[model samples]
Target: MSEDGARDDGRQQRQELGSFLRRQRERLDRTAYGLPPAGRGRAVGLRREEVSYLSGVSVTWYTWLEQGRDINPSRQVLDAVATTLRLTDAEHDYVLSLVGLAPRPATRADAVDIAPAQVQRFLDALDEHPAYALAPDWGIAGWNKAYERLYPGVATTAGENRNLLWLVFTDPSVRSLLDDWDDTSRRFLAEFRAEAGPRLSDPRYRDLISRLRAASVDFDTRWNEHGVGGFVSRERVFRHPELGRLVFEHHQLRPSDHLDLQLVVYVADAETRRRFARTKD
Candidate 1:
């Protein structure tokens, strides 16, 4: 067989895998929802039309999906389908795995746990720069006093939902803080989608998604596109109420043994650092 032919065969195998996984998920959904069994049934579980309606996808597309036609679905589309089918967290992870996406590790929840003492010490150590610990889903797990002083909105809004993705996409204050709002929003949304695939069944995850979908059209659009990329580096210009436009280098760290909790440190440039020092005076 030719190399091209071999590649085609591999693609076909993946599609077949996706279709089988979808069917199994549909079966689980039917049983969970107490839907009728396949008693001489033409099709098991949900009809393609029903699944399409629930997922906001075209019936033809869904049909192609079930037929394993090498459809490259966006994370948003997969997420919609997962929601419609009421898939469990494990099932959602399996769906992502079938499509060759990063599956959320089984140890995520345990990995996110940061001891109170560690969190306190970490915050205390960040003497001047703003820094915070975020949960896997970007919720504010903990932060330094300097963070609150630098970003007062964090104190008031952090309680609302500590998720940085949700804030960038939905909050007006966050938009005002960043110079290029659109690009920042897109990058954050893509990162959120990638991180969220593993935790789809978490109530907090669903709630955050629902809120963002209702609040931001741009977020809703990018979310459905299923763009995936890990958080490598983010350069943000924060228009601090006291310090003015301060640029910070944002880094995402996975320190937990399970790789769930993310430690986001904001380091200021020399100018920004000087400004921060003057702000104290």
Candidate 2:
């Protein structure tokens, strides 16, 4: 890369870092930090001084940091600021990448759009349990017959509409399938936000968010809240139209060779296994 190109890239990274920090800071309630809430007309987030004080950084330096001024913040300082803002694991890594403290994540463009044959075979080998592969942007790249049976829409949803987050929010069938749509949807949104990180500004991410905001009132409301969380493997309950009530442990894995692709699987217990077997018969 040319010297000029490197400079431009650094500038963009700083700007994105500043914006991300500001958003995270603003979304937090001052009261949660044992500080008084912002009064009527004041800005909603913690003031710069408050953050600096909490982070033990100089207020002037912190203000400059938010302004995207040409400055280098030490890893320790960044860590303190991230802690003060309660950034998640992914968010912290993103902040590090912005300042050349961590390696940048691979872009979706570098990844393949379809699941590898080996991955598809693995899904197929899952037998009755439903399993699917998710591309970097949460696109439903591939799935097994069991997954198709679990969510028939996956087999039919085409183009941009094939994204998991899009389906979770916009598909009425998904709402009907999940036993706890409100909680499940919110959790999914939070996880997506955390995973998206610096790529939130990418065109595809922006387009998806805009469409969801326009399509679902729930998504719009929750999105404005700026909630972020890491993914957790847990028991998920579903009310299948034909299968009735089903229980499974929702889990996800990343292939060593294809780190960007996520393999999401639903592992069934004995009762759920019997239910799946009955459907097969």
Candidate 3:
């Protein structure tokens, strides 16, 4: 392509990005988030100024962005903007593509299937252990009966509500099942930060953050602290109201054929193994 054509393409991308951002902001109910309309005048959607305030950018910078100026936004800045606009994971990636910063998603014609069902069967085979699979974005892609028996309904949330982080932060049942809620939540977030480093700007990560912030003040604190931890498999003890202290050593495994999937398995202690046997009764 000629230099002029290239420049035109770039300009077109910016325009598209600005338009996408406007739609996302306008569609979001300010009242739902407890923030008044942020744009100047009676603008239909969130104002550029509102976005700037929330995204930690100067009004001028944000204005330039919405005005379709040929400016490059960093990943962190894009992440903040996506969060402020409340974009979904898919939409977040779309905005990046508009800026020529990310590759466009493959069309269904060319796209392969996401998670496979066999993964669930594999989890089932680890009958003694609680096992589940997480998608690249950390949604529960699949789980064995053992996992469901332990963290019931966690990996099996119907529809779009099937996110592991969402369950961890928002679900009261899941919360009550934890032995140390605060410690466990923080560790999950830290591991998330580590796993999500390259994908910080992606809508999937931003959407999870937004939901967690809305649901848990503790999540808000730890996220803002910017702590990161390695994703080492560790032990956990879930204190059930009736089941008492159930101990297990959990570890993560990646399927060789599916790089985007993570398999998590939990090995129980002797007592917990016995408890597992009885629970099946």
Candidate 4:
């Protein structure tokens, strides 16, 4: 199959996996929580309205989603149901597993193998722009020289804990790079919460959460809100020291086999592109 076809297949499989897991969880909850069984009801599992109420999704949309009909759900909705179901840490991990984000086994080693040389070369080739590779849990795996120049203080700290979310929420220097600090921080925290559900039991993840909670009040508040978000394509505004306010489109490219490695590319607008070009010269 062509690469596009392969990607489409992966997307479809993930959708099915997500829906199936959700249905199973709902059924389990109905029994465990003493809700009526899925008998003589208009729908199987939890009523569409109940799931919608718990997940903050419209009833019609939730029905379509659970029915495995034509509907796309944001990570936020899936997360809400995961929280409502009170899924165990393992069950939460299973939810993410459906989407190809397999949790790190407890016995697994802490050390993650470095990104391939080809990936490093790809980052380096973007000489005039910022580009970086992130591990599954959003740790900074590798970055280009230009990325370092543009996003100073990003990789200055040593070790595997150099996570972008951590830097944005806890580090003052990184937080200052954005114009809309509160809005951006909340969205970032939500995204991290969605991703971290599966890894909450891991000591490494727990420690990271503790450190961030202690470091930033904003992080603590948003984390407690139990929000969730996904990595969708979007435009971001950054306040650069040299270039001033600049806009860029953020794109995330996930690996088919490895899944852990994600290539994030930032493309500047025409004005920002001109500024970057002039700075490089």
Candidate 5:
């Protein structure tokens, strides 16, 4: 985008953000915060100064934000404001996006979208464990037989729909397999947003987000909340159709040569191992 276009976009975003904040503030009840009722012709909502006092910001800075000035806002300030206004997760994220404070990707973006043959071979070697490779954009680039067996949808999901975030939100099979669907889906969205920070404006990223918002209400709501978090290894439980209840440790690895490619693996526990062994017999 051209510098002029960038400036124009920024101005519009700020204006919209300001309008949203003002509307949310105006909708609040003054008495709810222990303030007196509206006097005479005063508006019902809390005053700008009251908001500033409650949010720990200067009156001038808060006014500038509501007025859509060119001033920048830090994440801490925004969080404080959100708390003062009792904004929902989606509302908070919307405000952050306007100010460009969403979390950025921690990894380098030099890896290719397609997994190399060697990478596929490595995944194939994990015969008893479910493993898959993720591209820089979180697209499923490769998977092993174990992963396919665990969730058959991966092999059948068409292009664009093959994304991990898309599947987590839109795929019924995946939703059913996860023991904690609500928490897992939300966390996945947060992690995906963290990785997508630098690419938020990219056409591909926008398209994927747009498609997801249109396809699933759950995804759209979570996206608006703008939750973001770093990935961490944790125990995952899946109620497999064939294996009953399976427990495994979910881990992610980034190869030194392919920093953009993330390898997700599920290592089985003893009970899960015995179950798999029984199935083989």
Candidate 6:
């Protein structure tokens, strides 16, 4: 890249940093950090001075950093700022990248590819339980028969519409299938937001967001909320028509060779496990 081009990129990154910082601050509650709550006519979230104090930096320096001024902060200062914002893992990485320093590579849709046959075999091996794989974009990359029966149409959905967020927000069947659809949807959205990271400015990510907004009002509202979460194992209860109530915990596992793909497996409780065996019989 030319010197001019590099300078332009730096300027753009600074602008993004400023915007992201403001959004995070606006959404954070002062009281959540043991600080005074917003008084009448004051800002809804923590004030700039409060953040500076908490981050152990001078108010002028924090203000300059937020204002997109040409000032480079040390890694220590950046880490402090990130802690003050209570950023998610992805958000923390993105903030570092904006300053021409990337602690980790950003996961993108383009990086997703067909899962190896070995991955399919692994999912197939878990025949008695539900198991599947999700691509970087959260698309249904592969699944087993048990997973297909578990989620119904999810495994069969074609094209990019197979995305988890798309199905959760647009598919009526999905809304009816999950016992706690609202809670599940919110958490999934938060996970998706975390993965999106600095790629939010990318055309593909923006297009996906636009389509999601058109598909569901709730998704749009949640997206605007800027909530972020990690993908971790969690227990969920499902109402099965023939089997009655079933409990299962799901986890997201990444293969050492394929960091972009996530293997999601559902483990049933003792009673649910018995129900699955009986249903198979």
The candidate that achieves the highest TM-score relative to the unseen native structure: 2
Runs off by more than 4 Å, candidate 4:
1-110
What would you estimate as the lDDT of candidate 6?
0.82
The root-mean-square deviation over C-alpha atoms between each candidate and the true structure, in angstroms, is 11.7, 17.8, 14.4, 14.3, 18.9, 18.2
Best by lDDT: 2
Q: lDDT of candidate 5?
A: 0.86
Local accuracy by lDDT, each model: 0.72, 0.87, 0.77, 0.71, 0.86, 0.82
Instruction: For residues 23-45, write the lDDT of model 4, one tens digit per residue.
Output: 66556546555667576652336
> How well is each residue in 1-281 modelled by candidate 6, as lDDT tens digits?
99999988888888889889988888897667876657784536888998899999999998988888888988788889999999977789889988978685564466454568999899989876788888877777888877766677865677678777899999887787789998999999999889888678767788879999988999999999999999878898877656777788988788877777889888888888887887663
Better of 3 and 6 by TM-score: 6
Error of 5 at 98 (Å): 33
Tens digits of per-residue lDDT, candidate 1, 38-61, equal 556534476677778868999887
Return whichever of 2 and 6 wins on TM-score: 2
lDDT of 3 by residue, 58-90 (tens): 989877777789999887788889888888767
Better of 4 and 5 by TM-score: 5
Candidate 3 segments exceeding 4 Å error: 1-114
**Candidate 4: residue 275 Cα off by (Å):** 1.5
TM-score of each candidate structure, all chains considered together:
0.58, 0.63, 0.58, 0.59, 0.60, 0.61
**What does candidate 5's lDDT look like per residue over 1-281, in tens digits?**
99999999999998998899899999998877988877685547988999999999999999999999998899989999999999976688788888988842343444355688989999989877889999877889999888887888998889667889889988888999999999999888899888889777776777888989999999888889989999989999998988899999999998777767899999999888777666541
For candidate 6, the per-residue lDDT at 178 reads 82
Q: Distance (Å) between predicted and true CA of 64, model 1? A: 44
Q: Put down candidate 2 lDDT per residue, 1-115, tens digits, no spaces.
A: 9999999999998899889898998888777888876768444589889999999999999988888889999989999999999987678988998998974454543345679
TM-score of 3: 0.58
Better of 4 and 6 by lDDT: 6
